[model samples]
Target: MSSAREPKAPTRPTSRDYRLTMYRTRHDAAVRRLAASLRGMPADIPVRLAKPGSNLFRFGGRDRRPGLPVDGLDTVLSIDVDARTAEVGGLITYERLVAATLPHELMPTVVPQLKTITLGGAVAGLGIESTSFRAGMPHEAVREMDVLTGSGDVVTVCPGDDLFECFPNSYGTLGYAVRLVIELAPTMPTVALRHVRYVTGRELFDGLAEHVDDPEVDFCDGVSFTPCESYVTLGRFTIEPGPTSDYTGQSIYYRSIRRRDTDRLTVADYLWRWDTDWFWCSAAFGVQNRHLRRFWPVPLRRSDVYRRLVALDRRIGLSRRIARARGQRREAVIQDVEIPLAESASFLDAFSRHIPIRPVWICPLRSTTATTPPLYPLTSGTYVNFGFWATVGLADGQADDHHNRLVEQLVIDHGGHKSLYSTVHYDRSQFWRDYDESAYRQVKKRYDPTGRLPDLFDKVVGDNATR
Candidate 1:
């Protein structure tokens, strides 16, 4: 045995380790504070979250009650580069998550199109993007979650748990997620896109179905400009470096789809390509005009900014007033519905014949697992999510929800389900029937036995006051 002791190694923590420690400390404190706040609230009073903004299109009456404070919950807690797993705050937006992970060459398995869509919102309310065909919805990527139940207790839930299975489309009626551990996927420096044009909807669906399972393709989506014109855009990750196009400035991303056969974008831009123009809805604000776009500030060109403008218009009823002044009544026909791949063409045809909103967004998705979520029971086959946002003129005697009702019936007839984030016109019995009432009630009863939060039907389709 040597008498002299070997030199001791330094015990100081690395920068990344220190940061992760602080993040975890902060998250734990935040969760405790939120739980206490929920407990302090009166039992009879219904609770609601005080979010800074909302992506939901159902512009319901404001909940006058004070909201639960969630100040410190929006953050990326930790990213394990080796395991490709991220522990993030539920309120953290995908934009921040992307910013944090991109440097590590990792990203969430399925990142929604909009930058402001929070991870919790995406998981609880459901979200889809081009990658959904293989990766499934945002909830599917979550390995575990810490949810603040309506009983004012925090519990960790994982796959195979009843709460975990039913939580996706529960829309916060059960409880709110505070922290989630989600899986990540590797990424390259850039993405190469091919805009393949088709003459008809049938041809477009046929072509799109072929690429859904293509191992070479990493992203798949399409734009239907009209009944006669459609284009399926296929994107693949590439290490090949090239001069990528910039759509944040004078050029626009959606327009590029029509004008170019091929395009390239940095991974960040590729993920948010639709957000730059709100999927071309910014044209309604005249930002697409060559002259106006020149003066528009680059930083203000975002989906959230335009959404606020739309909200303002809704608050003041400005668009309704303008249309009424012009002797026309317009119904806002904004909705996203997922139809089976086989029936997508028929739905599109009926939609075009009735709604007249063009440039429908088409993204295909499939269940990554054998069993489907109970709340939004999508079968184990492929489905096409059709998103259209535009106002259509209502004839003199038409109900305000005439177009929306038509859409609901169309979805039902086509063996599809409509996303509840937007306006819903289904009757109570029918709504519960479609959403699986028995399953939802069981989960809701267990998580929120006292009915602290509004029921799913009440939250999405009930009176505006409850929403």
Candidate 2:
């Protein structure tokens, strides 16, 4: 050891320090405080680390309006670069994580298109992205997590642990993920992207399969405007920049039927490429006004544009009134169902005939379950997520329910699973038929013995008569 008389060296900037300094504050103690608050509370009480406006809380049949909201947990805890991991609070957004990791030349393996997605939401809600075909779901990339149980116990969980598997798609009904150590991978400064057009679902699947299976391809997704017209986009991290292709500057959104050539984009641009137009679906909001789009583009680039739109809808209250006036609970249809690759053609055919949604996003995702692991929502298979979202004219509220059940039937009939982020019409039998509730219940009992959190079945299979 050096002598005291000797000048001491300055403390070097570590990855942890660099990352922690990026955030405004650290609320590590808030984890246990939130857990303790839930100790004798009513089971119906809802707990969240973030505000309700940040998420689709009222989606599906359940209206999870917060009773006891837990705020101030949105902060980046730490980032350990040497271990290739980033420890983030559950409420921390992907946008913050991106900022913390980019300085270190690292990125989360799988990030949803929306940067507003929280680490806990992504893990608990089963988030996947274009890169999910290779890296698997965001939950699969979790290295470790600090979970607060209903019994006021804070437990550290890791992969292969019993409670770890139940956390995915549980919707925080089992327990709250206070902190998470997410695995990170090295990323290039830029990403090279190419789009290939396909006339049929089979051709689109074939193209997607080819790219997903290719080791060189880093990201892959497909957008179908019609049953006969689709485009498959494959992206790869690249050091050398090729021809410039900027989607933000175009007259029409990139997801439109217009053909495009290979181009290069910054990694951030590649990740949030759809934000400018919300996958060409923002035409519903009049962002499609070509003249206005040219003059004003900055406001459209906001990451929370979708959330803002919902807030505007709620603020105006006219949309809800319109639905009420029409005796309808829904005026739009937005659902994502992940089905086996083989069933894609059939499902798309049915989807085209039923909903006929345009700009259908199809992202290939590989299941991460073991060869014989207890069955989860996503069974072992090569699956493709079909994001079918569009306005559906409903004669009454019951019609929306009919559409919900019809879609659920189509998914089940085709051997697929639904994304719980949207409305789920599954009853107890139907829900258990798709998920291994037995295993989930066991894990729930072990961690949340007091039943402080909401019941899993109650939260997932809401008692709404619509179902």
Candidate 3:
């Protein structure tokens, strides 16, 4: 065994303060017998197993609540996985679980914004994605869940059953999810990669809706970015199995899926590319920031992209320019703002008019049916999420603040909201606007009446989740 242990940081909090040890064993969780050994430790902090390298560890940051406390941490007990359904450890990342179930030809129905999220996180928190349009949030993918209740016991919640309505996106608020049993779509061999370009916001959004509505597009959708002048939107659809005229189906592992192509990549490389955000954000930010990442947003409008498609060619020149400038970033805040899908075009136009921030890019996330109400209430209909990734200069703080206010206003104006998954120093009103208050309160009152999860957020839902 490796003698090296994780460095114990004196500054890192202990269970005494609701901080627990986070563990990552080489193969399995070494934490199984922890309940007995942790008898003397602070009861507040809970043990969590980090998703073993899979990005889909959990849909949202809260789902994998690894090391996050249960006094505030919510989990139910006993997980069971069968031929039709499989129960997974809440801490199970998507990759391991997917691979484990491969022999059975089954996969989780709903995944997260990114595949790296954990199964528990998807069931409990990872809410938005293309799969949502049809199958719904990762929770809708679940047929039943084995949850550990606040009273130190377990219970089951099944779809269409009496105790079926536990809110999945509550971030474990209803209970700690020990096991989640979800259904799977038939396994496919390869996905057809379709690439196209859009010219305006109206066209971009309309095109997305039409494309995502198709079932064969297993992972329907594309990313937009500005290569030279106009925004270019690339759409991808998973090809159905048959003798393909183009290419045969190959198992796409994550590594090959995530790549920094000025064009397209396999499933895995496209998902985890170190430069994906850069690629994803480049459409609005200008490939200039590649000084930091290879990928940036791909713009949706053709006219919005740079005239030249020299993203890879211009790397050297851009890098030199950035180095010469020194200290100040030539790029902007990469501001990440999201508005509902249906409300996208209007909000996009409104936000662009109000905020002077140039090269503002948009990333959309459609609402799902299985979404829980109030907290992450299922919208009356689908709402498109527009991410305004603003590229600003440090000198652009005024612009940043100005756009942030625009963000706050737009979020409220649209009946749609922004991304809570990513950090965006928001005000209480913004969070309240994004989430439902009454639903949050009811869940908070039920399990964590002591208010131990306040360590959870800085502003919204009472500003304090303390026990």
Candidate 4:
């Protein structure tokens, strides 16, 4: 410790601050009635809806937000999952979809955290991590989309249509992702679990790069540790039957991707990666509650955060236990930003050098698109990218401010743009830097003549939607 006689200095809050994005905050009933009244046009306006709750946060990819109304986007659709596809209303969470589709042997290759996520939300903001190298991004799974545009009209776009590509990761800024026609994955009863430890970020990434090429490998990644010491490299892949299959050390058949299906690992051990389960209050087992509100959008970088994250991952459970005993929520600003696959290394370097490292994960965005073109964060041709975010405990806003500066510069350095984002308090000029103005001006002119969507999203990257 430094000399205590020195003056006390100021500190920053570890939490990512959120502006109750509810302007003119209306109840679900009123919003639904209003949305219902405004339906039947070619454009769809943005409105909050009601939901149960999930791990995927719209703002920070942490705790779930209150649900909202998405039924008004449909056209006499009565069911959830169809024969060839699922006509999921924007409201349904990823857990419900997975549960509904399991019987059909159809897996929605969305964010691995499927137990709680929205089909529309996932499509609007794409993510395909370990499985992405195999399946591509979430948008690729969409068969068709019924977008609720700002023009007060609902437009249906499919694979061959012009409006098909702008659907995913655009966030809610380009109106709501009212409905989706998602593709499915095959069913496998058991997954081979592999845990290999590494000492450094390079070793972990190299290991991951090596394992991704194997055919049986379903998902693989390097868990936090150091390049000089031990780290967990966990993987889940399809299990094949034969004489060799019987000789296994440890494996499990997980119902959902949330936790490791463990026949032997303790609850704490099983959920070593599922940190939220430990952070939240649950009486189910002796789980304690740490009350730090979880949600903050932080830019994701790959290389730099990998090792720092490993160290944090190891301590989350124990720290939460202590916090719960003390009756204080663990304050964490979970910032998650996705970049193109090629940018992962450079971005990660920026993060490790700039921000306090938290747990990070990699996701994928499809390379091919019919209408949506490539820019910076918005890449073209099938590609993969990862996200880096931090979960810290603080009381002042300095941590958040730091995140802002890092992300702001990151955007410029990476030559990228964010789509349909939930900005904290940035200016229009910063947003405009990511997305251009020409396409947005034309589209704004045609649809929202009063200029509503731009306040939510900067501008469009294409001319087809505007026309």
Instruction: Report the number of the highest-TM-score candidate.
Output: 1
Mind giving the per-residue lDDT tens digits that candidate 4 earns over 302-332? 1112323433543466656776687654433
Residues 1-467, candidate 2: write the lDDT tens digits. 11012111311335445555544233544654576666646666655443454545244333444443356566766667788898778877888888888888899998787778888888887787888898888888888777777667677777777777678877777777777889998898898877788888888887777788899888888788778888888788988855545666644446443456566788887887776676666676666676666665665555477557865775677777987797656545668888999899899989888764676888899965462223345664789998876666565335545777788999988999887776566888888878777887787787777676666567655534211
* Model 3 lDDT tens row, 371-452: 3545565464655544444344435345424445556677778776543443344566656555666656654565445543
TM-score of each: 0.95, 0.86, 0.61, 0.61
lDDT of 1 by residue, 1-467 (tens): 11112212312334467776677678777888888988999988877778887788877655687688887788888788999999899999999999999999999999999999999999989999989988989999999888888777787788888888888988888889998999999999999999999998889899988999789999999999989999999999999978999989889998899999999999999999988889899998899999999888889899999999998898889999989999999988889999999999998999889887888999999888766888899983999999999999899899988999999999999999988888888889999878888877777777788888778887888446243
Judged by lDDT against the true structure, how good is candidate 4? 0.44
lDDT of candidate 1 at residue 423, scale 0 to 100: 85
Ranked by lDDT, top first: 1, 2, 3, 4
Per-residue lDDT value at 86 in model 1 = 93
Which stretches in model 1 have alpha-carbon errors above 4 Å? 1-16, 465-467
List where candidate 2 sits over 4 angstroms from the true fold.
1-25, 40-52, 57-72, 248-253, 294-300, 311-317, 320-330, 369-375, 395-398, 462-467
Steric collisions counted per model: 0, 0, 94, 37
Considering lDDT, which of the candidate structures 1 and 3 is the better prediction for this target? 1
Model 1, residue 49: C-alpha shift (Å): 1.1
Query: With candidate 1 superimposed using the best TM-score fit, by how many Å does residue 302's alpha carbon deviate from the native?
Result: 0.7
